[model samples]
Every structure is written in structure tokens, then in C-alpha cells.
Target: MALEAIKNQETLAVLGKKFDVSPIVISKWKLELLDKLPGIFDRTGSASDESETVDTEKLYAQIGGAESGE
Candidate 1:
């Protein structure tokens, strides 16, 4: 709905009705989406980056125990 509003694919009134929300709400959502869109794509400290710091040896030990029914 917010994307539609941003793209002008449909009027706020039309999108609001289709999504069962008010036009004002859709407008706010559109603005919020635009405001946060940049952060969503920022990869500096993203989950994938943090995942690289995980202790894989610890994880493998846990998995090995589980496989042996210990």
C-alpha cells in the first residue's frame, strides 16, 4: 500500500479503501516508508554482518551433541 502510494500507482483514497485504512494513514505510511527506505538497505551493521561474528565451533559442538542423542 505504501509502495503504491509512493509510486502513484493508485490514489490514496483508492489504496486506503483497498487496504481498509484511511487515506491519511496511507499517506503517513508512505512518508514513513520513504524515511526508512535508506536504512533498510544499509549493510554496515546488518544481521548478515553480525552473523559472521558467531562462534561456529560452539554451534558445531551443540549440533554434534544433538546428533549423538547426548
Candidate 2:
């Protein structure tokens, strides 16, 4: 629906009627989607950088096990 709104594929009134939501609510959803789109595509991976840690040793062990099927 938000994509439809962004593409102007249909009027808000039509979308609202089809989805059983108010036109204003649809507009808000469209705005919210627009506002977050940039972050969604952020390639820096900053969103999860703080909470994630790569265990190189564990990864290497897994790779070795997979190669040997053990």
C-alpha cells in the first residue's frame, strides 16, 4: 500500500476504501515509509554494528568441520 502510494498507482481515497483504512492514515504510513527508506538501504551496517561481534576462530572451526564432514 505504501509502495502504491509512493508510485501514485492509485489515489489515497481508493486505497483507503480498498484497505478499510482512512486516507489520512494511509498518508501517514506513506510518509513513514518514505522517512525510513534511506535507513533501510544503508550499506554501512551501522544499525547492527554495535551489538554484533564476529568470532573468527569459531567461524574457522565451523568451516574446517564442514570441509572434513565432521
Candidate 3:
């Protein structure tokens, strides 16, 4: 709602009053929302790729250790 109000060019003080929050809080929320907007439509999909694989063998080699099955 705050985001919509901000988009409609409402003053920060008005938004704060409508939402019962401080103007600074409204501004901070607006900034955070805008900062994360691009990630909502991200198509690179790196998060899935990172979670799909775990190269434990390579990790052990890098740290000069062997995978000891205990």
C-alpha cells in the first residue's frame, strides 16, 4: 500500500500518516522495496544452480583433506 501510495506521488508525511508509521520508516521501506524490485523478475536463475550441486570431493581437495567415511 505504501508502495502504491509512493507510486501515486503521495508525500512521505501523508504516507506515514496513512500507514501510522514515521516518514523515515516509510522512506526506508520504499528504498528497500525499490532496491529489491529487479530481483523479482530475475531470469539468470543462479540460486537454483548453486543449490543443485555440492562438489564435496573438490572441496576436500582444496583444503588438503580426504573424505573419511566415519
Candidate 4:
């Protein structure tokens, strides 16, 4: 799918016309894509960036003894 087309401010009817797909199909695609957003940050063999392993103790102390939001 074209990113430009996805970003355009077109109605579902217009988008369906341009892509030759029904609005229901387009909505399903959009929903499927949206549902994948969380995996973008999940690290357990997921699509998240960088290594999955980490030293939690060091990270905890460095940030704030188990209270830091970040």
C-alpha cells in the first residue's frame, strides 16, 4: 500500500475507488496495522528494536530505585 495514499485525507469511498478495494477491506487492513503498533516496542522475539536482554537491577538503580516512570 502507498504511504501517501494512506496519509491522504480521502474518504473511505474515495480511497476504495483509488485502490480498487471495498471500504470493509480497507478498514480491516487499517485495523490489522493498528493492532501491530504495540509489537513495535515489545522485545521478546517481537519487532522491537535492539537486543531483548537487559540488566534490570542496574537499570533500576540508575534510573530510580524502582519508582521512575521511565
For model 3, how does the per-residue alpha-carbon lDDT over 33-68 read when each residue is reduced to its tens digit? 887787767757566765448688864453343112
- TM-scores, all candidates, are 0.57, 0.57, 0.52, 0.47
lDDT string for model 4 (1-70, tens) is 3332367588656776676555555665567667775675664653454554778887445435323321
RMSD score of candidate 4 (Å): 16.3
List candidate 3 segments past 4 Å from native. 43-70
lDDT of each: 0.73, 0.73, 0.61, 0.56
Report the poorest 10 consecutive residues by lDDT, candidate 3. 61-70
Clash count of each predicted structure: 0, 0, 0, 0
lDDT of 3: 0.61
Q: What digit string (tens of lDDT, one per residue) describes model 2 on residues 1-70?
A: 7888999989988887786666766687799899889877665656567555878897566445544542
lDDT of 2 at 33: 92
* After superposition, candidate 4 runs with Cα above 4 Å error: 1-8, 41-70
Q: Which stretches of candidate 1 lie over 4 Å from their true place?
A: 46-70
